[model samples]
Target chain A: MLTPLTVALAVAALALAAWCGHAAYRDQPTKDWHFAGMAVVTALSVLQLVVGVVRLARGEEPADSTVIFVSYLVGVVCCMPAVGLLSLSERTRWGSLTVVAGAVVLAVLQVRLYDIWEGVGA
Target chain B: MPERNGDTDGSTGTARAAGTTGDGGRRLASGPGRLLVTLYGIFTVGAASRSLYQLSTRFDEAPLAYVLSAVAAVVYAFITVALVRGGEGARRAALACCGAELLGVLTVGTWTLVEPSAFPDATVWSDYGMGYLFIPLVLPVTGLLWLRRQPTDGSERTDTTSRTGTTGRTDGTGPAGR
Candidate 1:
């Protein structure tokens, strides 16, 4: 049930997380590369939200459309932005680490979204 | 007060004092603390919504599991607030909640495995939060570890400095030391 887009997003997010985690352990600052990754994540998340809404409108039913859509919406529009802003404020290694962690969460939530769409659970 | 900079402000002056004396625990409250709070807020909303949905949809199906989800949400919410508020009292509260979260996850994880029938549905702690990729399990441990390493009073000074010579702080005294 995973779309090609989702797969690509997941890989990209994971890669960003790995890079960010490495940088964090090295006690580095929040690099421009990390911000670029977050921007990608944000863009992809918005795409996913739009896709979800379209699917719902097209009669594609999830196990719980309300919950599924809400989760996705929150993750993209609210949670991700808030985390990104806070990390920028910190401007430390831990701040970068937070971005890394948030990327991981975003990837996992994408998986969850896929499952919800397909009406399955692991 | 309005024109006073962060370092010079009398209100924030306590933070400087705390930093020098290792008592201004609020440093984290503003910086990395806010980031953590944001994450916790997401978890709080997720867990709370999930639990409420479970309860409203099927209270009779798995009361214990659903109730635990609600508890997890409350803990996340509390921790988020404590981290944002930033003070000795807030830190204490956060420490207690984080500790309880760790214990709760373990206990519920074990209970669910041993008594599957007891939990017809999944709680945040079920399967040691495998559903959440065990972040639930790891977060509290990290929070508690951070809390323990923090100065016992209310200051934010730790002795573990990096090579840069900056005082011991969470990020290892920046890249200058490295």
Candidate 2:
């Protein structure tokens, strides 16, 4: 079951990805706006991790807790930080594009997490 | 490749005005290079972490595939570092790693297809990187191509100088049209 919050977050992530891709080819500097979007996505991902664990603890059955938890944790910890660091190093429009790539990866992981929750594999 | 007085001066001034960044010794790596490096970093971390988790949990079930995943992870890590480093040393390392990756995906991808029984489950290159939308397969080729386009001396031989008339593109690729 997809929640409104999750859907909204996914949309935002996708939007960020699109913007980053557009900015990369432009060869402009990635101003603060790109970072801000990444920061927001990071916060939402953290929230999702908390909520996901809580749901699992409340006698909820998932397809595989191990895979689900790992995907969530990695999405939160690795994707955002890596993107941030890469963007800073870029110092160009491509920096923003890096952020966008991270967002898309994060969003895909989010979908994978949801699939894990449903236990479709089971 | 040769160092200039203004370039060694450590200012975006006459150095960049003369056309270049990070000292005239360094050439314009370009926005695309940066973007490509960023993507490689993401994949490096993503693939490495996933492989580690998979290996730690179920080594017994499919040792061959999981081990290959770990190898792929290491290769990606190497490539990421090389790409971001972006110098003579880094470029050579990156090209080598990219070449390895291309071979790996192709060989493993075909091996998996031919001998499905050998691999109980999927690896990163199991189906020619179907899991990653074939990006894993394509990235190496693209990386090699891009690296070839750059000067081998690890200097910014062509900065905005060649494209000065069109200042629209700072990297000398083309006008970005921001």
Candidate 3:
């Protein structure tokens, strides 16, 4: 659950980042399709979050502190929606750039999530 | 590959923005300012939440680091608000805050370097924000430059014209309209 799910989520996140990066490069706003892409990544994160929370409920615990581990899990799920709302309000090239920032943050959070779960950097 | 239909009626982007402001014009939260706001908003949330969690759960482990993270979150929140407000007063406030933020980063960064034991846990500005890819160090400088480029009260018209004309150059890519 940990390794494969993190990989899938990080890949989805980076894919959204690349899509938004192209939009930023072309100096365009985040279009409907970009939102669609974010939706995909976000839905996957929601699934990941459910699985994580269920595991914790069942008696599974992360290698690190459960507090920060749960925080990272929750953080991944919120990133896309927050950026989506933000980019929607702006409606400019910077809006697309905002997506890029959010997606990159999401990706990095994925890595940190895995690290926290595995106690790699702890 | 190029999708150009990003704006609706695109004609009013620059003109509408320019006309709406009061005597002191030039929105700092325009083109690049939007990106800055997004980044700052993220940092505000991230740092604030992390610090609160750390302070609540493990105050005994590293009080100094958590306090610094809380301070970083406050500064980020201030800058995010200033950018979103988009007025002369807000711009100056952001500018002053950016300077203070840079000073904080430098002070914390050097202190951590000189005395690593003081920070058993990491603060946001530890070693110049290396934990966060040095973005904490770079962000203040970027905010400073962006705020400085904005037109103040008396120099509104000419500053707007010149910068908007060449804004794309400074921006790397994108229209001057924001």
Give the distance in Å from residue B57's predicted Cα in candidate 2 to where it truly belongs: 1.9
List where candidate 1 sits over 4 angstroms from the true fold.
Answer: B1-23, B30-39, B154-178
Interface RMSD of each: 7.9, 8.6, 4.5
DockQ, per model, reads 0.14, 0.27, 0.48
Q: What is the C-alpha lDDT of each candidate?
A: 0.70, 0.68, 0.80
- Deviation from native of the Cα of residue A77 in model 3, angstroms: 1.5
Question: In lDDT terms, how accurate is model 3?
Answer: 0.80
- Model 1 TM: 0.80
Docking class of 1: incorrect
TM-score-better candidate, 1 vs 2? 1
lDDT tens digits, residues B1-178, model 1? Answer: 1221222223342333235544445654543454466568778988988888888888888899899999999999999888877667777789899999999999999999999999988999999999887878988876776655555554344442222332235544322211
Candidate 1 docking DockQ: 0.14
Per-residue lDDT tens digits for candidate 2, residues B1-178, read: 1221212322332332343444321332334565567667667776787778878888998899999988998998887776655666677777788899999999999999899999997888988999888988988887887665565552455443222132232445521222
Best by TM-score: 3
On lDDT, the stronger of 2 and 3 is: 3
In candidate 2 the C-alpha lDDT for residue A8 amounts to 69
